[model samples]
Every structure is written in C-alpha cells, then in structure tokens.
Target chain A: MAGNTTPTDFGNPVINWIDKRLPVFTMMQKEYGVFPTPRNFNYLWNFGAIAMVMLMVMIASGLVLAMHYTADTKLSFNVVERIMRDVDYGWLVRYIHMNGASMFFIAVYVHIFRGLYYGSYKQPRELLWILGVLILLLMMATAFMGYVLPWGQMSFWGATVITNLFSAIPLIGDTIVTWLWGGFSVDNPTLTRFFALHFLLPFVILGVVFLHIAALHVSGSNNPLGIEPKSDKDTVPFSPYYTVKDLFGVCVFLIIYAAFVFYAPNYMGHPDNYTPANPMVTPPHIVPEWYFLPFYAILRSFTIDIVIPFTDIIIISSKLGGVLLMFGSIAMMFILPWLDTSPVRSARFRPLYQKFFWLHLAVCITLGFMGAKPPEGIYTVISQICTFLYFAHYLIVLPLLNKYEKPLPLPPSIHEAILAQKK
Target chain B: MGNPHSHGAQCSHDAPQKHGQEECPDNGHDESKRDFIFISAASMAAVGTGVVAWPFVATLGPAKDTLALSTTEIDLSPIQEGQAVTVMWRGKPVFIRRRTAQDIELARKVDGDATAFNSLRDKQKDTDRVKQSTFGGKEMPQWLVMVGVCTHLGCVPMGQKPTDMRGDFDGWFCPCHGSHYDSAGRIRKGPAPHNLAVPTYTFLSENRIRIG
Candidate 1:
C-alpha cells in the first residue's frame, strides 16, 4: 500500500490530477496540516519545535562556514582568522555557526527536560525517547569533531585528551586509539577524517530525526496532564494551533540567538581557542565546552582507585574508573525508561517524584559548576558528592519512588481541567 | 468557553470551500491583498537568507598559502655533539640530536630483547636510526633526527634541556607520562607505545638536513 492514503481532492484540476498520482501534497497535509495534537500543551512543549528550527539554522550556517574552513592543522586557525577578517560576510556566518551550536544544545536540553517532566518516555513512547537519546549522542560526537576543525589551542588539545580516553581500555585500547587517529597521534589525517565524518553525521541526525518524528506521529504527542486524547473534543489539528505557536517560539529563539551572534559572540567560547595549537604548551586547565561540564565533572571525580576491601589489589584504577563513569553517565540515560517504574506519567501529579526531580536538577547544576572548577581542596569533595547524588537519583531514587509514591486524582477530561482552572 | 470549539469547527467546515474557490473572482478582495503581502514578505526573507549564506560556501575551499610552508630545512653545523636542536616542521617539533661518541656507544650496547618496550611500531635496527652511516662517503653515526612528539600523547620530551633528567634509560624522557627513550630514540620504558617516530628526511650535505 502507498504511504499516503488521504483523499486526493485539491480543488484545482491539474493539482488534483498530480495529487492522485504522486500524493506528496496529500501526505504533507495529512502529516502536518490536519495531524491531531492534544490542546493542553504549554510553552515547555514548544522546545521540540524550537530545537528543529535550531538544527536547520546550524546546518545552514555550518554549510556556509564549511565552505570557507580549512581542516589542515597548520592552516585551519589562520583560515578561520581569514574568514573573520577577509571573506565577505564570513564573520556573520562564522559567528552564527559558532553560536548556533550552543543554541542547539540549549534547545535540545529543554526538549529533553520537557519529556522528563511530562513522562513522555513512558511505555508507548519509549522508542521515541530512545531515538531522541540517539540524536543526542550523535550531536555530542558531531560537536566534538566540529570543535577540532578550527585547530585552535582548545580544539587540538581537546581532541588529544578525549581521543586518548580510549587508551584506558584494556590491551587493545592503544591500538583502537591509533586506529581512530589513523596514526600514532592526532595529526592531519585525524583532522581530515573528523572533517569527513562531521560533514556526514548531521545528515545521519536528520535521518534519525525523520524517524523520531514519524514515531511521534504514530503515538501522537503527550501533554501536560499526561493523559491520552479520548475524543475529538480533547484534540485540535496541529496546523493553525501548533503551527502558529511553533512560529512564535522559533521567532523568540531566533531573537536570543541573533543577540549572541551579534553582541556577545565569544561569550560561550574560550579565549585560549583564539591562539593556534602548540603541542608543547598545554593549557592551565583542559576543560571541554560548557555543555559537557557535568559529565566532565564525573570523569574527574574518580581520583581514588577502587581497591578490594583491605587488600592493595586494585579492582579498577582511578584512570579507568574515570573513563567508565564518564561514559556510564550517558549510558544510564539510555536505560532510564526501564529504570523508572512509575505508573503515573506526569510529575505534576506525582508530588514525591516532583521533589526529587528538582533535587536532581540541583545536583546536575552543582555538578556542572564543579566541573568548571579546578579539582582541588573543597571542589573535589563537593564534586564527589554531586556525582554520587546524580547516579543515586536515577538508579535508586527513581525506582524506589515509583514503587511507593501515590499520584493525585486526574481530571475527567481536558475540557473539565480547563473549566476547573477557570474557577 | 464553547466559542473556541465552534470557531475551530467553522474553519474545518470552510476548508473544502476555500480550496474549491481558488480560481473564483467573487472571493473577498481584501484576502487577495493580504496574500500578496505575505508572498512578497516570504520571498524577501528567502532572498535575504540566501544572500547571508553565500560567504560560508565561498570560503570553504582548501588554502594554498600554509600548504607551501609544510617542509623545513635546518642547519646542523651549530649543533654540538650530545646536543639536540628542535626545529619546526609542518607545525610540529622535530628533534635533531648530534650524538657524542659516548652516546652512540651506549645506544649500540642496549640489548634488543631486554630494553625495547615496544619495538613492533618501528622495526628498524638502532644502526638504521640515522639516515645513512656514511653521508658524503664518511661515517656520520653521531647524528639522530626524530619528530620530538612523544608516542603516547604528543608532548615534547623534557630531556631536550640539558638540566632536564633523561629518566632511568639515560636518554630523552617525557615528564608528562614518564615515557623514556634511549639515545637511539627507541622506547625503553613507561606508557609510550613505540619509538620516537623517524620522519622522512635527507642530508642536503654533512651539516645540512631537509625534513618534510
């Protein structure tokens, strides 16, 4: 059967004939125009649309930046300078692209948090949430590789530090790192490969995003109340309602993005990255981009080796433990759908779950703050505590909360909830 | 409260009629005027976006200026025996060491099976570390040239400074991760996976060398 089964009746004779044969317009109308969405979605629900807009903005600006970028280690830093100083409007494109990465992450984080608050990851939507997590992983990889293209002090050293992380693996670790670098070190070949993959992976993300949306359409969208649409009265067509809301969201996001691109372009960037890479001089502190700080904190927290009881026989070295914990933080997220045993979908109805959610947010922010600080004196102890809280919130608290917590009574319907709110 | 639902239903009911009336001249004239404004505004935005996107596409091609500076030639005449001079080549540090007779003897006496930690990366013999034993038809065993980056993580070895300790192996030592190399630049201990890499180079003369 054809994918587009909607009626082909465009009023125009020629358009109607074409729709009967090809049906692209029909599919668009069915999928986007008349697609049913719950009416109660709030401003937080707009982040998914905002994220999609940011992705497009990033790709457009990234394409323009790529046209002028030179991936060679020696020339990359200079070419970026040339783009700023010499090329026509290259400064605007580069700034937009540079700032676009931060905006993209910001939008995606909000989108993910929205899903968490509404329990959009529950049962039927598990695959949708999993696809989203995959997109996040791809984004991290893309951002990491994209950072290296400028060949700045941070870019070069960051690649060396992150890629060298593979060496913490057993016997074949060094070999795997070498294979990734395509040589003994991160050189021109590594840059070339990263550039190729960076150029490639956004398209792969776009494909995954397509699947993500298709999956969203199948199950429909979850709302603030976390209740399914039981009747036509509970839902509205996406076009006029969601399309107008999404447009307004995109416009507001663009204003903030434009501010960053124009006024405080380098606010999110490190000053060290302006200098060309010198392998001899390591930066005073090697920190990743601000978005990765929470995980970076987790990596630096494991300064003590795990020894078996009283014996000196090391179960895991500090170095290896750091590597595992850093990766495990993300790996834990992939399993969160299974970890949360709650029958209730929305945190708004679950009072106990809501309290832990706020605490979890605090732990994450604290971890991010600690990540940026030097791992010394009081900072290390705080980081260790925050890291413990982050894991415990997901692994222990979420499972336990699901079993014990009782949820508030739900409204009979969306209309009833709206009427109650009016009182 | 009921007005919103009624408004939505009215629009859905009007949708088929609106599609059917595309070519009709009897439709509201003000609606056509608003449609014209929307079309022009949208077209202008599209054009503006395209204009803004052009420079990024224009500047992405390969650069020719820096590629020309990839090779470097260093003079070895000023370098004394047991001294290593670092030269910049392709934006990396390359070490050119003029070995003393004592250094050469110590390097040659190093046992293959006992000292070499990871010899599999560069299988060349200690004698082969130098480009040619005889350059200009004379013995030139005192010179050893290598890219200065450590095999582990690209840090320059510390023993380039005379005051710096050469580790337990009595040669170049990388303080960053404790990788030690013998006088022949062979990896002998610590975390380095292989020897200091030998770059492609040629002796322009007895005292001159070109490295790419």
Candidate 2:
C-alpha cells in the first residue's frame, strides 16, 4: 500500500484499492481522463461523442420497445401501433428509437465527412477509419433490419425488394435468397429471424465501437488542423476540456432530437409503413429511407445490361450491375485512403480538393434526391450521371487532385495556428 | 532433472527469474508432453465450441413448418368473367383471372401472331399461359393463372382489381417500376425482365383449381 505503483491515483481510498486489483479505474483515467487530445477541435469533432450517445439511446429505447413488440407478420404492425397507443410511454420509447436512427446517421455522416475533410484515414489512423466504416456497415444492416420489424407496407416491400437483390447473382442466387427469407417469400419466419438478429446486432455495433475508440486512442484524434499534437501546449487533457465540450455538444443535439421525438415523431417515417404489409398490393413507388437514398439511387441507376459490344455475349445483367455499384459505393469509402493519396492531411491546405469536396457532397445529395424520385424520364438520367460522379469522385477526381493540386502552407502546429489567429 | 511441475524447471513462474532463465516453464523437460496436452486441449475446445455453435446457425434456415409446403385449394366457381382474384399460395399472391371473351380473343390473337409471340420477354405460347378446364360440361380455357408478384422486384401487379391501371397491354401493370404485362401476362415494357411467373396448378373439376 505504501509503494503503490498503480496509475489509479484517485484520492478516494475505495477506488484506489479496487484500481490496484482490477485497474478499471486506471484504464478510464488513462483513456478518457488524462488522455491528451487536440485543443483546437471544432463543433464537427463533437459528432463522434454525439453518435456514441445516440447508440445508447437507440439500445435503451429499442430494448423497451422490443419487450412489447411481436415479430409475427400479422402482429408486428399492430403490435407497433399498440405500443404507440397502449403501452405506457411506449410511444416515447419507440419514437426515440425511430428518430434516434435518423439522429445517429446525422451524427455519423458528419463524423465521417469530418474525417474526410481532415485526412483522418491517413497512415496510422487508417485502421481507426476502417473500424469506423465497419461500424457504419453494421449500423446500416441493423437499421435495415430494425425498419423491417414494424412490418408495414414499406417494410414488407422494402424487405422483399432488397432481399430479391441477392437473386441478381448468376448462380446460387435464388438459393441464397431462399435461405435469407427462410421461406418462399418474406413472411413470418423472415420477420422472426430479422427480429432476433436486429436485437443481437446493436450489441455487435457496440463491440465494434469499443474497438473504434480503442483504435482512435492508439492513433489519437484528428483535429481540424489534421496535424499531430506535438507538445503539451498543443494538447489538452481529455477529461475537462473534451468531456465538457462533448457534453455541451450532446445537450444541444438532444434538444433537436427531442423536438423531433415530441413535436413530429412520425415525420421521418413513411406513411405507407402505417398500413400492415400486404403482399397483394405493392406501394406505387417503392423507395428506401432517407439515409439509404444515395445507395438506392445507385441501385436504380443501372437500367441496361452491360453487353459485349459486337458480340452476342452479355457481360452482366442490369440488376447485377446495379447491385455491384450500390455495394461498390459503400466499398469506395473503405479504399478512400488509397484513393486520395494527397500527402496533406487537411483539405484546407489542399485548395483544389477543398472546392471539389463540396462538389462530391453535392453529387451525393443529388443522388439522394434522385433516389426519392421514380426511376424514370429525367430522374433516371440524372441518377445515372450522379452515380458515375459518385464513383469517379473517389476513383478519378481525388487521385487527380492528389497529383495536381497545389496545397496552401499549413500552420506549424495547432497551438501555433491558434496563436497566429490571435496575432 | 527435477519434476517439470516443480520450481526446479523454473520456466512456468509468473515473473521472470534471474536464475534458471533458460530452463523456464516452456523449456521444461516435459515439453513434448506439455505440447501434446496443449494441442489436444485446444483441439477439443475448438471441436466443443463448433459442436455447441451448430444449433444456433441451423436455426436460421427455413423452419420445419415452412419447409412443409402446403397446397391452396381455390373455389374458382364463384369468380365471374373478367374478375381476377388473388389467393395466397406459399405466402405469395397467386392471380387467378376469369378472362372475358375479349381477353381470350386478344390472348389467342397474340399466340397466333408470329411477331408478337417472338417479342415476349419470356416467349411462352399464350395457350401455354392457360390450362384447359371443364366448365358447364365444355372444355374451356377461360382462366389465366400466374404468380401476382412483379418480376422486377416482387410487387403485386394492379390489374387484379376493376379500378386499377392495366398498362397498355390490358393485362396487368406493376406501378412500382411501370412494368406492363400484356393480357397474356408477358412482360411488355418497363424494368421487369421476365413475364409474370406461371405457377403449377391443376383443375379439380370445372371451376375449382388447386395451386401450389
């Protein structure tokens, strides 16, 4: 006790006693307390913390809703309605989950874009960025499954359409689809399994999130300047500085999240989802949620089969092409570090990329807009162009910028930048 | 050569020792025996884990009742000409339409015409689309039976109801992606690559039919 070498130097006797044995307290202090973080973080830096809060909100609310919701094709829809109507504060719990998904995406998309703007995916932090991408994929999967749980018209048709995409594969595609559905079509069995997996996946996301943070801790955070914290002057302890900033950020985010939960709970959801799933009647226009719009646009963009020119043979069917491109769009982010080989970390320093970043973002937003429109006439054409631009941004534009763009001189350090601004 | 389990080997110590550093727990005389124990232990554990994991993985496949395919018996007698009814077959909508005289004539015309039949996405004869069944003691081909789901993305076509929009083909229209099926239930336009699928069925007698 006299020669305590343990880093858990909490003045409290109980924590110190337990820290020597388990060292859990020491870990918290090391990772979240005395952890050195960049002092010059902007509001965008707050989103990672915001996303973490939304995950907990989703899990907690989802757990309570899961207690009341039935996963049967017949009952799942009514059960959700009942939860909104009968179960005590079930509306609140369900609404939180419903809107929490949107908020989570809002935070994560900002978090990811922030990563893109800064070169957070560069070198040592590539693993950290990759882990973040994995979390995004898991979140997408979980959210898709969760959307199906309500068993609404959109839920049924959406599940049917999305699962049927698997059938586009040349061989064993139908077999894979049959296995996924667990029956001839999306029915009770599919609902039950989706429910089971939906419940199981958030925890998986949580596990990956733990790894994301662990990797983040290893590489440390990427600030607005996108430079390493060279000295203590440039760095601030994570406890008071970041903890308070993150808390303030979450509080502001919660107000907006709460406004949606209270004033307009069902605003983010589809009206078609209110009707129970009817296989006999499909929605006039089948579309995915707002978060999935960009990829959905890409999926619909492939209208013609890629055929071998001047030959009878076909390269790939239109459906298969769309599926590949849709998935490829997500895979694009995984290879982004390799794609954008600019030595500069922050886009601010790279004058050309900074401007083109807006163009890429605009293309993505346009794709999302096109996704909501019926895949026809001018919409399909626009979707096709945007889809090309979406892939080309990473594949062609970024690499070209890496080679050609003349970057502005960077401040010596984060502290120097702050001092320079003052002067 | 002290017993490997004892401190004389010194290799298995929790901390590094100044003495007998080379003769650590891993360098014990029973190294071969220890490795055998470790390998067998790991193998058994891996096998045990896999054996335990089988049931959870297997449960995800089609359930026993789902695999037990059921046949749907439709009372087509009540259905009148030009009325299309959807019956649940294997949890999917199976459209059974009592074709009107005009509908039959149009379908037969397409079958007789060489150009139209060749133009079909899935070129099956119109005669092939309908099955011969007895009604009023006459061999008749009045009913057009096919899976109601759209071939593009599995949305049920809208021509089953009197008010719904039947695409120019006068068969059914899938509004989801604007796939137009001619009265023969063949894909005419839009994104759907194939005709509305015809399901296996047999006429029980006259107006009743059984579909799977």
Candidate 3:
C-alpha cells in the first residue's frame, strides 16, 4: 500500500504540470461558456475550429520529427532512415507529419470552397477571404520546399527543374538562377537555403493564420444563407454549439488520416525517391507532386507554335502556355464574388446557377484528374475540352447567368427557411 | 425577463406582442430542433467519408519491418580496380570505385588543374588524419567511395571525364549546377560547400571489403 501510494505521490508533479500547462477542461468553460459557440452556426462554421486542431496535430508531430531529423544533405536522408528504424515509434511520427500535410490541405481547400460557395468573399468579408488565400499560397510554398529536403532522386531533380524555371525570364534569367543557387548549380547551398526557408515559412504561415482569424472574428461568419444575424434572437453563443460540432468533424477527419498513415504510406510518393539522387541518370519522366499535376498538364497542352509576323518570332511554347493557363485558373478565383452576381446567396434559391455551379465543379475535378494522367492522344484531347469548359464556365456562363436568371424569393429568416421546408 | 411594455393590463390588448411572444418561444425550440437534425446528418456524412479516406491516409507511414533492416552490411569484394558500382545504404546513394593509377596521380597532383583540385588538400589531409587516428592507419584510399549527393540542391553530380569543358578535374560534374570535383571526390569548384561524404568501410582483403 505504501509503495503504490508513494508512486502516486511522485506522479503528482506530472499531473500538476499538465494541469497548469493546458487547463483545457477548465478554460473550455470560462472562455467558451458551457456551450459557447453561436447557436445558429451551421456545419460550414466548423472548418475554422477543425483547422485549429489540425495545426496543433501538425506542429506536435513536426516537433518530434525535428528532434530526430538531420538537416545536412549528406546525412539528412540517412537520418530520416534512422528515425524510421532506430527510434521508437519514429515511423508513426513521420506518418503523422506526412498525412498531416495532406489533411491540412484537404481542410483548407474545403474551407476556401465553402467561402466561395457562400459568397463569403463579398464586401466586409473580402479581406478575411483574401487573408485565407494568402495563407493557402504560403502553405503551398512551404510544402514545396519541404518536399525537396529528403535528398531523394525526385527531391534533387525536382529542385533542379523548379529552380531552372527562373531561367525562363528574359536577359537576367541566368543571373537569377545563379543567385537562387548561391553557386553555379543546385548543391549544398541550395539545400541549406531550402531547409532554412522551409523552417521559416511555416512560422510565417502561422502568423498569417492569426491575421485570418482576427479578420474572421471582426466580420463574423457567413452562414449557409449568406445573411447576417440581425439581433440577439438571430444569434447563438459560439462555445458549446460550435465546439461540439468541430470536435465531431475532427474525430472523423483523424480516422481517415490514420488509415493513410498505417496502410499505404508510399502511395503518394514516387518510387524513384527511394533511390538517392544520381546526376548521371535522369528519370524517364519528370513530374511534380500530384497537387501540381493540373498545372503541369496545362503547361504541356499546347502543341502548335504561334509565330509573330515579320520578326520571325515563335510564341506560345506548350510549356509557357501551360504555365499561363495555370495562373489563369487561380486568378479566376479572385473575381468570383463579382462574377457570381445572382441576387440570392444560397444555391437552393437559384436553380440555373446551381446547375452551372455543379457543372463547373465537375469540370475542375476532371481537369485535375486529366492533369495527373499522361499527355497521350486521348487524355490530351479530353483535358483540352475540360480545360476550355473550366474557363468558359467562369468567364462566359457565370456573367450571362448573373444577368438573366431569376432567383426564388429568400425566406425572411433561418427559422422561416426551416419551417417552410417542413411545410 | 418580463418586458415592461407587456407588463401593464392595458398592454395585454396588443395582438402584435401576444402573437410575437407566442411565436418567439416556438422559434427557439424550432431552431434547436433544426440544428440537431442538420448537425447529425453532417456528422454522419463526415464519418462516412472519413472511413473511406483511411486507406489513403495509412500509406503515409514507413513499412513495419523497415526498422529491422535499417543498418546493412555491404560486401566490397567484386569491385575491380578502375571500376565503380552504386549501392543503397540507409536509403542514400553510395558509390564504390576502385582507384586506378591515373586516378591516384590526378587526385594527388595540385597545380595546373583548371578547376583547382588543390583546394581539397587541407580537407583531404584532415580526413586522412581522422582515419589514421581512428583506425591506426589501417584504412587508406586505394578505393574511393562516397555518397553521390551534391552538397547543394541535392542533385547527383555526373561523373566528369578529364577532358570535360566544365573542368579538367575528373570525378563528377553536376549539370543542374556547374560544381566540379577531383578524382578523389573532393569538391574542387562549384556551389557545393563540402566534399562528398565518405562512408565507413573496411577492407577484408585485396578484393574483399565491408561497409556499414
């Protein structure tokens, strides 16, 4: 009895440490109230809270990885191997970080699309949405640089190919390449620089996320109906309502994240990366990660050269065309709030707009899928058609539909919409 | 919380307030009910999708047996003089080359080499010193072996011939960046800050060797 009691007494410090450090259970009551979240919030509002949880998961796993990782080009790859092999549960930590990245992206994309679907970008909330977009771009940059640190064949060659793209600029392209490389080529300097940047950018993204949330809090959230709450009657406390919903979403997201961590870790990784970088032999096909495939497909799409008259200039290389199209795809999103001028906020109230919205979504997904596929005869033709439709839906159909479509009358309130549905 | 306007007996005649109060109570009850149904439905969908996403997520971890084979012992017997072969150790490229007379002479000679192979004199001396101290002069370089990774940007440097225009030093040249190195695998010129790392190895015989 004394032995067990003494052990429990000794464990008091650890328990006390955790209680003082986190205070999760107690703070959950004070700051959030017993059920703190705004009562009227729908499922769309859960994403922000879900994103916060993912950030914590990523940071915790990432810190564990950093403890074991060696940043040097020579030992970095080997060190990763050691961690996976020698360290207890190192593979679990690595899997969490890897899948955490994917899940983070998945959550962010949904959050952004939810904003788009609801016209949350309009007026007072524009800055909030824009900040979110900035966060996304920074996240992509951070992930891209991080992927190259492993010193695998793909990591090496991928860095080379991407850094070389700066050479596409006129006149000072070579200088830019050299400046980026810090030597004649991508070598130790490049690796060190990339590692430094990768370490730094995540913090920058964190800062931006803070700003995003601040902006969100100021403007409040747009609901499914895209209408602001008029009074206390329309609003609900944010704590209990949103906290519970977010918790549910998080548990569900983790289940999927766990599956990927355990079973098919290499499904997203290229086989060539298992081999260390070899300058003598180039892989048969150089491809970026799957996320970049759509843009890569667009870059490879054009076959014909558009020649400039008199000067004997050839314009529009397939690579350049594809690059332009990629930028065009993202730039199109900036104008969406304006392009989608339908009076009604919800798709439920606008039949024609809903049809076009679904069609556009399908086209985007198809284009992304096509982009991942090899640029063979049939795939190329299909991709081109999908690509054309992707742009056409935004540039042509949206503007035309905004002008012509008549939307059903919006219900007076959330309560009204619900009651009307019941009737 | 009673409203002052509705407290008076005369105000009880107002139909608007009576109707509003009647509807207000139902409104809270109605909204909560709707929220419950929506939240439950959404939760169910999220769970279903999450279940489906498991296999894709599980692929992110390393193989279960990977830790057992983390450290490997490689035999170096079949490597002939003036020949090289690559082997993977700890998931990195490890190149093993038997040095020829020409290779040794070129590596030692410091001057007139356009790429300045002499820059490695201090580095080579230091490595030699460390090897001597650690192994009591047991392991000397009759063979050259190293990780092929360029210290910069991680590109694999191509093996350079003596006549290559990038530099006269004949070890490897990285096409991605114009780094040059000597036959001893010392970085001579380029963006790379250090020489290629030499792995730990021991010769069992003139032909046989062991690397861990």
Candidate 4:
C-alpha cells in the first residue's frame, strides 16, 4: 500500500471489477510501475535484473532437464547422455541450464560487488544484505546438489569430498556423515536425496529473493552516489526507465551466455565428468566448479593441525580447521556491515578503501586460481596467503581503514551529484 | 439490535475468544477452561506436526534395500599373488590383496621402523591389517583385506590394477588426493585422516572369504 499508488480504472469493466477485489494490478503498478528508483545507476546496477532473468532461465531449463534425468546411479549418466543425443532440442535445454549456472553466478557476483561498492549493506539495508547472502548460500546449496544429479565422476567424487567435511566434528561426526550419505558411501541414496534437495532449494532461493526485493523496497535502492534522494529530480519511476534498461542489459548478457552454450558448451565443465561414476576408480584431481574455487582453496589451505602451546594438547585438527575456515569465509558476509564501520557507503568517496577493494578482488582471484591447482607445493602456500588476505580484507583492512582513511565529502543529494558530474 | 443479521459479522469475528462470554459469570472457570483447551490444542497440534514430519525425515536416511547389501563373499582362488582385487560390499569397494613373499617382507620390514610408524596418519600394525588364511592346513598372514576407498574423501585408490602406480610406499595411492598407503594399507602421507579401513572379514576355507 504505497501512498503514491491508487486504484485506477482501465477501459474495461471486467478488469476494474477484478482489481477492486484482488488488487493485484494495483500491486504491480505500485511495485513495478510507479516505484521510485535512483536515476543515476550505472550498467553494474543492471546485474540484479540480469540475475533475475538467469534465475528464470535456470528454473525453466532445469525443470525440463529434471523430466529427462534419472537420479538412479546406474542410469543417471546414461540418461543425461540420452537427453543430449536423443531427445528433441534436449541438448539446447541442457546446455542452457549448464551454462545458466555460470551465467547466474556471473550476474549475482556483479550484483553483489555492486552492492559492496555502493555500501548497500549499511544502515536499514542490513537485513536486505543478509537476505541477499542467504540467497547466495541457498543458490550455492542448490547448485552443489544439482551438480550431483548426473552421477558422473565429478558428481560422485565432489559429493563424497564435500559431504566428508562434516566428519571432522568431534563426536557423532561419523554418524552425521552416515546420515548425510544415507549409507556408508555416496551411492543411490545420496544421489536421490541430492536430486530432491536440488529441486527443493531453488524454490527456497526464490523465496529469499522475494524477501530481498521486499527489503530493498523498504530501504529504497542505493545508487552510485550513495546519497538519499532529496527530491523527485533524484529519482525516476520504475516502469519504462528501468524495465527497458534491464531488458537491454539482459539482451547483452544473453549473447555472451548463448555463445558459451552453443559454441563452447563444455568450457566450464571438467573433462572427467564425462566418465560415469566408478566407485572402484578415482580421478587424479578433484576440483569443484569455478564459482566455488575461492572457498575450495580456503578448504584446502589448513594442512597443519593447531596445537595449544606448551601442553602437547592437540585441539582443532587440520580437517576441522579447514572446514571452519572454508565456512567462515562465507559467514564473514553475514557480519560485514558491522565489520566495516565506515560512514561513507560508496567507495568513490573513500579513496583508500577503494584501493583496498581492488586488492581484495585480486586476493579472491588468486584464491580461485590456486584452488584449481592441487593442494601441494607452491599452490598451498599461495592459497594460504590469499585465504588469509581474503579474511583480512573484511576483518582488518576495512575496520582499520574506517578509522584512518579520510573520506571525501558526500554530495548533498543524488540530484546534486548528477548535476555536478554533468558540469 | 433487533436484527440478528446486523450483528452476524461481529459475532463470527469474535467467536473464538468470546464464545459464551455474554452468558457466563465473572468467575475464572471459563478462563481456566479456555486456557486448558488452548494448551491441549497447541500440544496436540505440535504432536501431530511432529508425527507428520517423522516419515519425511526417515525417508532421507538409508533405505532398506541399500542397507540389505551388507556382506560380500569372494572366491579367493582367482586372486593372484601381489595382485589386489576390488569387490563391491555395501556399495563400497573391498580390496583383497594376495600378498607375495616380497610384499609381506616389505610390509613386515617397516613394522620395526618406529619412526615410520609414528608418521602414519592412522597407525595400525602390519599384523593387524591382515588375517590368517589356510594353505595346506597351515595359517599364513597372506591376504591383506581392507575397504578399497581412500579415507580422505572416499575415492578408491589406484593400486588395484597391475599397471597402476602404488606410490613411493609400494602400497595403494589415492588417485583423488595423494594419500599413500604401505603394503599393509597404513596411511603414510597426504590429506587422508586415516589408514585404508580394514573391514571385518573371515576366511571360510582355503579359497573362500566372507567380507562385511
């Protein structure tokens, strides 16, 4: 019930009669039609819309893929191959979904980074940001369980390795792990459960995304200038302006995504995944999908067990340590608003923070690069350093910068900022 | 006030909380009864919800069919000396290595290496890793029986085949990670938190073994 929106009579009597009872059209007009949005958002802002499009793309493709897929370990891999080779345009649907994951992640990462750069996590938007993080986590879980549906080598092994992480707990760890597997190993039970969950969690992500949008609406959209809209001049209606811009952005994004799907379908996929899962045979190297590389690197970085000094008391075994660090990397986002302590929302005003932001991005890329390599020799060393830096960016760098770095004066309003930029 | 239809909306709206309130005395009996009913309803609803949720949670655990394939019997006669053969048991691989004299010696030689034993991720003695099998009515610790999966991430190690590299320790090496095992299946190096697991097994005769 926005103050700006009112019941409007369309030319038809049926529409007017229905609107009086349901008010759905009224909601659409309020939320999407006449909603006030910041006027001067960059191309990066388009990613949120792009992510929404990809989500729908993934869901549609995945629904079709699920119909053809067999989750039984014996037939799953062959089922996937059959879908690709035999079914009408099944290859197209499968490829769209396969690349849709990477596309979705690409859009989401940019959306997240845009949020971070603009301090979208600050103030009244803490819950909004938290909701976004929750969606990310759900997406990660959905993506992970989805990866296991094919019952290919990577699917089986990836499921095995990731699920085994829970076994590092002190007591009942093995029991919990057994419960996770639904047996002694990642067999039919695990695959079936993963399939069910893979189907379930996307809907969960979609629900959280609804909450994310609801929260964003409550706070109003954060812009590049990081200033509140002081007047009508600073904002535009959501209808034609953003709807058209977002459509164009989606078009541009689809071209790149489509190229990968058609020309280089297997570019992001591991070659070993083509082979059916063999409980008796193991692939030489087991790497997770690229979106998870940074965290995977963090998972592998803790090689030495932490011992309490002078007591010969071994606490926090290396396995547990690695698991903690890997999870902690993501948990950092949940508490990021409190950690930064900066008044300025946008990095444009904080030169020092902006520099560190690039460094943080570099550290993440380094972690991703090192994650692809085996956890041995120089790779582990690099991973360790990058992992440490990745955490430090939130824990140390941002907080310290908040205290020391001098921020330039924030413009009085979004409108003024745009006017000044034009000058 | 005369028309009952006029008050129908209010009556229905307040019915649950104010049921029979107008006729009741100002005593606490009705309130207490309401409380009792509320608590009972809540408790029953909770129990009902929990009862409904039990099967959904149960479905996620191991099904009966998966749990049924608990034991595997192998004909040991076909397994050659110095060769490791993998057999399916409980949806996992069980490795049975027919040890040659040198393989036994190589394993036993390291038994006395205290420094080497200390390096094991999950320490187990060579004698502990193998069991006696009959040959001409004489018992020998010849067959090394263990679960074939690597303890790190459960990838089956690569030394089962004749051509596969068994790592520096002359034992199975995990192809997924680099966990090395000795001839006795003791984890010597890499990310594996434990030695290759020795499953419960017994020799039925000279040529048959039952593994679970």
Q: In candidate 4 chain B, where is summed lDDT lowest over 10 consecutive residues?
A: B1-10
Residue A381 displacement in candidate 2 (angstroms): 1.4
Clashing pairs in 2: B11-B24, B11-B25, B12-B25
Worst 10-residue lDDT window, candidate 3 chain A? A1-10
Number of the top TM-score candidate: 4
Candidate 3, A158-244: lDDT as tens digits: 887677655545468557766676554455667777877887788888898888876766777677876666655555666556666
Which structure is stronger by TM-score: 3 or 4?
4
Residue-level lDDT tens digits of model 4 in A1-423: 635556788767898888877777888878899899999988999999899989999999999999998889989999999999999999999999998999999999989888888899998789999999998999999999999888889998899889988988878888888899999889888888899889988888888989989888888999898877888998999999999999999999999999999999999999989999987677888999999999999988887767687543558866788899999998999999999878799999999988988898889888989889977789988988998899999999988998899999999998888788799
Model 3, span B1-212: residue lDDT tens: 22445344422323335554443333354456667889999999999999999765453323344323344455667766776777666445667776777877776565345345333422553234112322344545656768766554345666633243334476777654445677777766644545777777665554454655
When 1 and 2 are scored with TM-score, the better candidate is: 2
Model 4 Cα lDDT, one tens digit per residue, B65-120: 87888888899888778777888898788888888988888888778899766655
- TM-score of chain A considered alone, across all candidate predictions: 0.97, 0.98, 0.86, 0.98
In terms of docking quality, model 1 is incorrect
Say which candidate scores most in lDDT. 2
Q: Which lDDT value does model 3 have at A116?
A: 63
* Candidate 4 error regions (>4 Å): A2-5, A308-314, B1-48, B100-106, B132-139
Q: What is the TM-score of each candidate against the true structure?
A: 0.71, 0.88, 0.61, 0.90
Deviating ranges (above 4 Å) for candidate 3: A1-44, B1-212
Tens-digit lDDT track of model 1 for A197-219:
89999999999999999999999
Q: lDDT of candidate 2 vs native?
A: 0.86
